[model samples]
Target: MMTKLRKIILIPALTIVSLSGFFSCGVDRWPEYAHQTALDTWILDIMQQNYLWYQELPSYDDVNLFVEPASFLSKVKSKQDSYSFVDSVMATPLPTYGFDYSLVRNPDIDTAYNALITYVIPGSPAAQAGLERGDWIMKVDTSYISKKYETYLLQGTKAVELTLGEWKEVEIEDEEDGNEGGDGEDEGPTMEYRVVPIDEPVEMPAARIVEDNPVHKYEIIESPVKNIKVGYLMYNSFTAGTKAEPEKYNNELRSVSQKFKEAGVQAVILDLRYNEGGSMDCVQLLGTILTSADRLGEPMAYLEYNDKNTDKDATILFGTDREINLDLHSLIAITSGTTMGAPEMLIRSLFLEDVYPIATVGSSTKGQNVATEQFINEEFLWSVNPVVCTVYNSQHDTYGAISPATDLKVSETTIDGSTNYSEFLPFGTFDKDGKSERLLKIAIGVLDGTYPPKDDKTPEESATQTHFKVEKSVSSPASRRFSSKGLRL
Candidate 1:
C-alpha cells in the first residue's frame, strides 16, 4: 500500500482509496492480512474519499504509522472537526458506576478542581449510594479530584471510592477583631469534604439503571407574577430508543408536544443544555413538530455529501405535525456547550424556517455542522461513525454552533474552588422549578423583563466564560465519538 501510495504521490488531497477490496464473501469478506496498520490504511483511504473536509487531511509525510487506527483518524482530520471520530455503538451509555458527573476548575486554587454530581440516574449506583445533585466530589479513591490529568481516572474506573464534600455555612472573620468581619453580614457556606456511606460498598460497579425517562422533564409551569402558562421540555438527546423501536421514541416526543399543546402553553422553553446531538431523522421530525403548519413542506436544512456522493444531497423539509399551530410560536431555547449535532440542527432549522426565533440562553453550542455516516467492517463487528456530509439551513448557513441570543451566567460555576458553586437545581424543584433552574429562569426573566437582558454574544464570546468544553466524552472510549444511533426514551 505504501509503495502504491508513494507511486501516486500521496498528498493532502489523496484521501480517497480504492475500497473495492473491503467487500467479498464469507471469511474472505474481511481483509486477508487484517493487521492494525492495514486497518488504519483502510480507514485513511475511506476517509479521504468520504470526509467532508478531505482536502484538510494531513499530508502522507505527516501520518504517524505507529498510532492506532482511531488515533490516526483523529490526527488525520482537521483540527476544526471536533465531532468527527470513530467509536463503537455497542459500549453502553449507562455509566459504569451508575453516576454521571461534570468536572469544573477549582477557582480558589487554580491548580485544583471539583467533580460536581450533575445527575444521580434514578436507580444508578450514584443514586443508590445516597449521592445527590450538587455534591462536590473532592476525591475518588484517595486521588484528589483536581485539574491534574490523573483526576480523569474517575470516569474510566469501574469502582470509585469517593471523598465527598458539601457546602456548610461559615461565620465571617472581622479584620479588626476576627469576628463577623467589618460588616455584620455573614460569609457564605464552604465545601467541607468527607466520605458518605452508600448502600453498597464504597466502590461502585458499572451497570445499567432504570433506563427510561431520558426525557428528564416536561412540565407546564404557571408564572408566579403573570397569568401566563409556559411549557418547559428538558430534552437530553434525540434518540428514539436504546433498543426499542424508533416509533416508540417518536411517540415520546409526540406525547410531550401533545401535553404542552393541551395545557394551553403560551410560550415554551426548550432545554438542550447537555444534549450531544443524535439522528438527523429525529432532527427532521423535531423541526416539523416545533414548526407550525404554515411552514410545512418548507426546507429546514440541506444535507450535502462529498464530491463522490453528491447524489445523496437532500432537502429536509418540515413535515406536518398534530399540534400544528399551538399558541407556541417563538420559543426560548436554553443551550450549553454540549448542545450539538441534531439539537443544534433543530434550533438552526427552526430559526431558519421562521417558525420562531429560538432565543438561546447559556453558552454557545458544540459547533458540529457535519453529520456522520454509519459504516462497518465487512464482518459487521467493528462499526465506524465517520464524518460523511455537511448540513446547511434553508438559507445555506452552516453555523458550527448556534450562538445564544443572550449570554447568561447561570450554569454551575465554582467560586474560590471549594467555597461556592452555582449548583444547577433540576427542573420542577419546588421553590425553584420554573423561575429557579438557573438557565431556564434567565430565559423567562429576559422575556418578561423580570431581569435585564444582556447583549447577545457571539460563540467566541460565550466560550470565554467556560473553561471546560461542553461535550459527552471525558476521554476517548474503547470505541466512541459522542453520538450513537439510539432511541431517546
Candidate 2:
C-alpha cells in the first residue's frame, strides 16, 4: 500500500529554469517546463493522447490552464477515474529527509492535526534521530501543525527539525448531553500536548530507500471444520525488486510464501484489506505463487494501451518457477474499499482464470483498473504519472470496482499497547490465545461453511465490523506504492 510514509522517494529536487523555450521532448519525453501554463500544456498534451480516460478530459478552454498542476489534474479528472492522479513530485513536492507522519485532524484541537509516526526507515535520518512508529508528532518546529501545512512538513530536504510529543488525554465537559457527573458543567475529555524541545536542525544523508519496505505479515491457524490448516497474510503493498532497492518486496513475498508452505496450510486467506497497488511484477509474482502449478506458463491477463501504442500492449503470464508455491485451488481474500490497483487486478484476473477461484469478503472494492507510468523530462526536472492503459482479465473484462463476493466490513482492533490509530501487532504475530481476530473469524467461517447463516450477522456483529466515522476522500493511485509499470531512464 502507498503509505503516508513511503519506502521510496518518488520525486527529487527539480532545479530546471525554462518554460516557453522548446524542450528536447519526444512522444513521452517532456521538457522540464517550469511555468504553470507550459506545465499544464504538457500535462494536457500527455493526457490527451495517453490517459485511459482521455476522452473524458475537459477542453483546455474549459479549465484553468495555469493553476497548480495537482489542482488542474483534479479539475479535469473524471469522477469515474479514481486511480489516475498527479503526485506531489510533479506538483507541490514534499521532502523526505525528516520523519514521516500520517497527519489527521486532532479530534480535540480544531486547528491542529494529530500526527502518527507510522514507521521509520532504518538507517535513515529519522531512525538515526531515534524516531519510530507509535511516536506522537507533537509539533513540526515551533507550533502544532495544521492540516494545510502537512505537505510542507513532509518534504525531502537536506535538513528539517521535528518535535515529537507524548499522548495525553484530559477531561472536559460533555456539551451534547448537557450533563456532567454531579455538577452542571465540568471537564469531560480533552487531548492536550506537551511540547518537545529541539535545540538544533538535523542534516540528512544524500539518498533514501525509494521502494516500500513492504509490511508483509502472515499467521497459521486450524480451521474449525475438518481440521484444515489456513494461512492468513496481511499484505500492505505490492512491490518487486527495483534497481535501486533490489528484491526489497519480492523477497518479502517469497519469505511469506515459505512460511505458509512450511505450515502445511490447506487453504490460504490473502488479506489485502489495506493494500494500495504497487509493482506489476510483484503483483504477478504473488499471483503465480498463489495459483496451482498446472496454470503456470499460461496467459493470465493482457495489458492494452491506446491505439497509438499497440506495440506496448502485451500478455501477462503465470509461472511455476518461484521458490515456493501455495498451489492454492481457491483463494479467500479479505479486502476493503481501500483495496485497489494491482490487488484489484489480481482478484479480477484470478476470477477470470476460472482455474483458481477468488472469493472476497470485505467492503466495496475501490475499482481502479488503471495503470500509470511515470515519465520524466530529458532534464529530469519534472515528472508526470499519466494513465496509459486499462487492464483486462483473461476473459477480456474491464472494470472500475470489483464487489466483494461477501461484503463483511471488519473494523480494526487495538491490542493492549497498540491503538486503532495504528493497528500494531508486530506485522505477523501468532496469537497463541487460540482466539481468532474479527476478520479472521468470518473468513474462517467461510472456509468452514458456517458463514451467512440467518443469525450469523447481527446488529451487534455489524457494529463491530470495520468502519471509519471520519470521512476520507477516496485515496488515489499516487499514494499506492508510487511506481511505474515500465522502465525509465
Candidate 3:
C-alpha cells in the first residue's frame, strides 16, 4: 500500500513540473526590451509612478494605442526640466452649466423693472400682442424686472401675461382745425401695443455666398493699396462631426476657396484669431487643400516624448502604419494668444516650413503640441495625452516652439475695433504702436513687391518704414485722456 501511494503522488508532481517548464519557456520567448541608457530608465520609472495616480482613475479601451517611437524619445530629451509636463498631464475641464439668452432694452416706464420680455415666441402670446424689437415690456404677469439678472428666470417655454406702462406707435393724424395749408410743422401721434410670449426663430446674421452656394460668411476688404483684395475666412471651430461622418467643414472651405478663386483674389488671409482648436484630421485636410505643391514634402514638425517606452523600433512613422505622406504647403495660418491645440499645430507646421505666419497677436502660444487619443468605457471617458510624435520643422527642430515671424501684442481694444495695431511683444506692457499693422503690411508687401527691400534701405530707414508712433496718453487724478479718434470715453 505504501508503494502505490508514492507512485500516485510522484505522477502528479512530475506533471506539475512539466507544466511550469512549458510556461516559463513561453514567457521567456515573449519580446521584452530594456532601456538603452540610465536616463531613459529614470524617465520610464517616473512615468510609471505618475501613471499609477491615473491607473485606477479609469481605463478606456475604445481606441487602439498609437505610439510614435521618434516623438517618444524626442520629448524625453526636451521636457526633462520643464514643469509643464506635470501640469499638462493633470489639466482637465470641470463640469459646468451653459446658458443661452437674448436681451432687449427699454427706456420708457417708471416701473421699467417689469418690462422684461418673457417667452417671446412668434405666433405665440407675445407676438400676437404686437411686441417687437424696441417695444417697451412693462410686466410679466406679477413679476418685476429691474436688473438684467432677473431675466434668467424666464428661460423655458411658459405662458405669462404682461402689462405695458406705455407704447408709442408713429402714425399720421388729421388736424381738426381747417387751417391745414398754413403751418407745415406736424407731430406724429403715439399709440400703445401689447403682446405675449411665444416661440419664434431668432434672427441671426445671414450666411454669405461662396462659389455657387451660400456658405461660410466672409468679408472681402480692399487692400489699402489697389488691385489686391483681402479675403478673410473666419473659421470658428473644427468640431463639426466625427471621422466617420462626411466633412461639412471641408465642403464650406471648398466653397470658400472656389469663391476666392473666382473673384481673382491674389492673397488669402485665414483669420484663426479666436480659434481654440478641434479635430487634427480636419486641420490636416485643410492644410492639404490650401498649401502649394512645392511646400508639400518638407518637414512640417517634430514630436518629442518624455519617456522612450515604445516597443516600435522605427524613427519615422508616416500615414497609416507610417504609410501616409503629409502635404504641408497649402496654408498661411494666422495665430493669436487665443489659438491653442490643433490650431497651434497648423501654425507650427507652417512655421517649420518657413511659410509666412502673416500676423500673430495677443500672447505667446499655449505650447501644447502633444497629441491625445481618447478612450471611452461604460464608467468614464479617459483622454490620454500621449507624446505620440515630435513635430520638426525642415531643420529638425523638435520641441514645437512658435516664435512669431512677426510678433504682435494684442489688447482688448484690438478686438473691440478701437486699436488699429497691436504691440509686437509677449506681454501687454510693451507698446508696439503700429508694429502689428506694419507686419501685415509687410507680408502683403512681400507678395506684391511693393514693400521696400531690406537691402535697398538702411537699418534706420527700414525701422522708420515699419514703425508707427502714437501719442502717449496724459494721466490725471480722475481719468486718463482718451485718443481723439472717438474710440469711446
Alpha-carbon RMSD of each model: 9.1, 8.7, 20.9
lDDT of 2 by residue, 1-489 (tens): 234643333332344533333444533233333343666677788888887677888888676665656667888877876556654343322334434445555655677765666444545666676665545565655557675765555543445566665443333443575454656563445532322333443433533443235544577878766688888887777766555666776887788789888888878888787687877787778878887777777777788887777888978887767557787887788887778788888877777444666777767678887788776643324556777887877677787676665444444443222234333223333343453455666777777877655564443332122221332122212223444446210
Residue-level lDDT tens digits of model 3 in 244-278: 44455556666666666666565555655445555
TM-score-based ranking, best first?
A: 1, 2, 3
Regarding lDDT, does 1 or 3 come out ahead?
A: 1
lDDT of 3 at 335: 58
Model 2 is weakest, by summed lDDT over 10 consecutive residues, at 463-472
Task: Quote each prediction's TM-score.
Answer: 0.72, 0.65, 0.42
Q: How much lDDT does each candidate structure score?
A: 0.61, 0.62, 0.37
Which ten residues in a row are the worst by lDDT in model 3?
Answer: 480-489
Q: How far out, in Å, is residue 208 in model 1? A: 4.6
lDDT of 3: 0.37
